[model samples]
Target: MVNLIRNENMKLYRRWRTWIMAALMIGAVLIGSFVDWHYDNKDAGADDWKTQITQEKQHWKEMIADPKTEEGSKNYAKDQLAIGEYRLAHDIRPESDTMWSGINGSAQLIMLITLFTVIVAGDSLAGEFSTGTIKLLLIRPASRLKILLSKYISMILFGLLLLIVLFVVSLLTNGLLYHFKQLDLPLVSVDSAGNAIELSMLGNLWKSYMLNGVSTILFVTLAFMISSAFRSSAMAIGISIFALFAGAIIMELTQPYAWSKYMLFANLDLSQYLNGRPYQDGMTMTFSILVLAAYFILFNFVSWFFFTRRDVAA
Candidate 1:
């Protein structure tokens, strides 16, 4: 199994497209860090954070008090207001464009990581079949399940490598740009009960990456299943990419329906719970996890059934 996984990883890295994806991910982190530093570096040394918080509090208060404000907007404003007040009372400054802050902001780039992973995963099995390499793989002494597991594990390892690259590049890029200060800064957020709390900056960043990883794993699995079942890399990649971007829009459209909570797209974003908001009123982290687990099982089952039972010549 280890040798097979290694062989699969070698095949993946031998392609020019894989290196191109890594280069692009690094370039994005550099560009984003530079842009943020250019605009916000000056404020990193500002001493009037208390004044800034006061101003932000006033803005949030105004937003909350406005009669025309939507309920959601008002609730968000109230949460921010409470958090800002907590910061002032506790003498905690809001994160500026510091190293840690830039690292945290760069978490958004995980979407790019997901896209690249989906591309690799979508092509992993389908590319083999399309190129008539499946017969060679099947003739190997390894069982069909072992071969499939190896390919899937190799793809997941590649995704994790991209994630590590993103984190390391973002850290160095932002550290150089911002001089690596405020390593002990705390992240302030409001809990479900509107109470403000402080969390470790590093811990929060770790949590963000982990939660983002759930969606990445799901999308990669979905692409892999499509590739295995359909034997078409293009279709698998296209459909997975479409779902990645359109999931939020679909969730919004289906938010009014109670059954929408059970939809795969609706539950992909486990991070919503961390923000104290579920997609719908009754949806919780546990509910989303259960839905995602069921979908995960279904996708893998289809892939296994198709790959092991279907005729390669057909």
Candidate 2:
């Protein structure tokens, strides 16, 4: 199994497209860091942050007090106000335009990582069949399940590698541009009870990345299932990418229905729970995790059934 996984990794990394994806991720980090540094308000004094917080608190208070505000908006404003007050009381200045801020911003690039992983997964099995390489793979001294597992594991490893590269590059680039000076900063957010809570900035960043990775795992599995079942890389890639972008829109549209809470797209974003705001009133982190686990199992089962049982004599 180890040798098979290694062989699959070699096949994956040897592709020119794979290297291009890595280069694109690195280039994006550099460009984004530079742009942020170029426009950062470096001359702002310590009091500037306090003033900004005061203004934000006033804004949130006004929003909460406005008669035209929706109930949800009022609740959101109250939460923000609570966080602002906590910051003021604790003198915990927000990490704005700092190295940690840039690193936190770089978490957005996980979407790109997901896209690349989906592309690889969409091709992993179907590409072999399309190129008449499935027969060679089957003739090897391994079970069909082992081969499929190896390919899937290799694709996951590839995605993880891209994530590591993104973090490292963002850290170095932003450190040089913004100076690694605020390493002890804390991120403040409101909990479910509308009370402020503080967490380590680095720890929060890592948690955000992992939470975002949940969606990536689901999408990659979805693409892999499509590829295995349909034997069409283009179809798999296209449908997966479409779902990645359109899922949020679909979730919003379906929000009126109670069953929408159980939809795959609705539960893909686990970060909502981190901020104490769920998609719906009853949805919780446990609910989302359970939903994702079901989908993950379903996708892998479908992929396994198709790859192992279907005739590949085309």
Candidate 3:
């Protein structure tokens, strides 16, 4: 099994499509960082959003600096002032690291990895026939199901590689472009995990990296399902992305449609799912887990059944 997976991985990785996808993933990350740096590097007056943050900050400071303000309001103003002072001294923007980490984590990773997964997974068995590679694959004394599973596992890992590349690209591009040497990420509020475990600067980056990796895995599963059905790599990528966009639009167009609550994309949004604000109530971590598990099982079964019965000749 180990050799089988390795062989599949190497073959998939060597394809022109594989490297092209990786290049695109890296490209996407750089593009995102550039867009981020464009605004973040600008002065506070350059954009409306920046102006808003600055204005609100000043307003709050005034509320506190006002001599007649209530004691509680004054105290609250002091806290904001301290935080604000920390920002001005450090020259950090509102988001700095946390915001980029999240944006790359979900949007960039999901779209890039999903596209790459569709190509790799869609071509898994179908490419065999498309490229006359099926004969070689079948001659290896392996069952069709085993070969399919091998590709499934390998492609899933490939999806994760997309996310890993995202991290590397963001670090390099954002680091140089923004001239940010290092960041101090505030981990625990001296509240969440007790005082014993304080999160360090490096630890924050690592945590964000790991979380983004997990999110990639979840999004890739859907690609696997779509790939299992379609013979064309293009179709698989299209269907996977279309499903994502469609789900989001469904939620917006028909709020009364309670079924929108169960859309995979709706559930894939772990943050919103955890928060439960934009959607209806009852969306918690446990609920997201259950939703993801249901999709995993259903998709796994669908892929297995379809691939097992698919016409290799077709």
Candidate 4:
């Protein structure tokens, strides 16, 4: 198992797409930081800078009425209460406009990463046949299932590495480039008028980070399965990314499909989960996230079963 895993790891490391993603993440952080630095120095004695958070919250709240969910109710109450508590707290807004827009672009890239993961890992078994490498692999003592698992595990690790690099880059750049010098920040929720719940700054960051990591893992598993079955890297990437955007559109087009919550792209935002924000009116973050977990299991089963049962005739 260890040797098989290492072999897969070597293959993943050699892939240039993996390195390009990491580079993009770091590059975005650096560029964003520079932009933030210029804005901070250029504007002085103006409170409009802090109004971004308030404006976004107000806009977001208007988009969904009550969300009518248990978690939504809780968040609403907490956010309202936060407005009361943080009245005399800080001079700045809870979050920045750049934070709202800038971070979203980076977040979108995660879905792209999921597609890449599927094309890379899912195709591991199928590719052997596509390229006639199955003959060489079968010459070994390892079971097909074991070999496939090694690729999946390596893909997961590669995803983790990409996220880690992104986190470190975001932390250093966001902290230094933006004037958010203090690591200790008050927790503010959008549910309330201004401030609802308050947590230490460090606590919030760690919580946000972990949720993002877990959600990414769930989305990648789906892509992996598609790749395994299709053996067409382009198709795997195309479908996964199309789903990332199209799933919501389809979900909206027909409300009768209650199973839309189970879609991979539907659960992409980890922050919403941590914030106790509802992805949909009927879905709790935990429940919606569990849907993702179930998909991961199903995909794994299909991939393993099909790969093991298929004839890799040379």
lDDT digits (tens) for residues 195-288 of candidate 4: 3545554565556556666655655566666766765556655676666567768766654666666666566664665555455656766776
Candidate with the greatest TM-score versus the true structure? 2
How well does model 2 score by local distance difference test? Answer: 0.90
lDDT of each: 0.89, 0.90, 0.62, 0.61
Question: Tens digit of lDDT per residue, candidate 1, span 22-62?
Answer: 99999999988888878884744456888888999999999
Q: How many clashing pairs does model 1 include?
A: 0
Model 4 residue runs over 4 Å out of place are 46-81, 87-93, 97-109, 178-180, 190-195, 256-280
Worst 10 residues of 4 by lDDT: 96-105
Better by lDDT, candidate 3 or 2: 2
Give all candidate RMSDs, comma-separated. 2.0, 1.8, 6.3, 5.3
lDDT of 1 at 179: 75
- Residue lDDT tens for model 3, 1-314: 67779988889877787898788777777677666665653544523444555777798888977889988576656655555555445454444533444344334455556656765676675566667777677777788678778877887777667766776667667656645534444432122222222345445555545544554565556666666676555666567667755777877776677776676656666655311254645566677668778888898788778767876674
Judge candidate 4 against the unseen true structure and give its global Cα lDDT, from 0 to 1: 0.61
Provide the lowest-lDDT 10-residue window in model 1: 41-50
What lDDT score is found at residue 301 in candidate 1? 96
Better of 3 and 4 by lDDT: 3
lDDT score at residue 55, model 3, on the 0-100 scale: 71
Candidate 2 lDDT by residue in tens digits, 147-259: 99999999889889999999899989988886677767898987778899998887888788889988999999999999999999999999999999999899889999999
RMSD of 1: 2.0
| Per-model TM values vs. the true structure | 0.93, 0.94, 0.72, 0.75
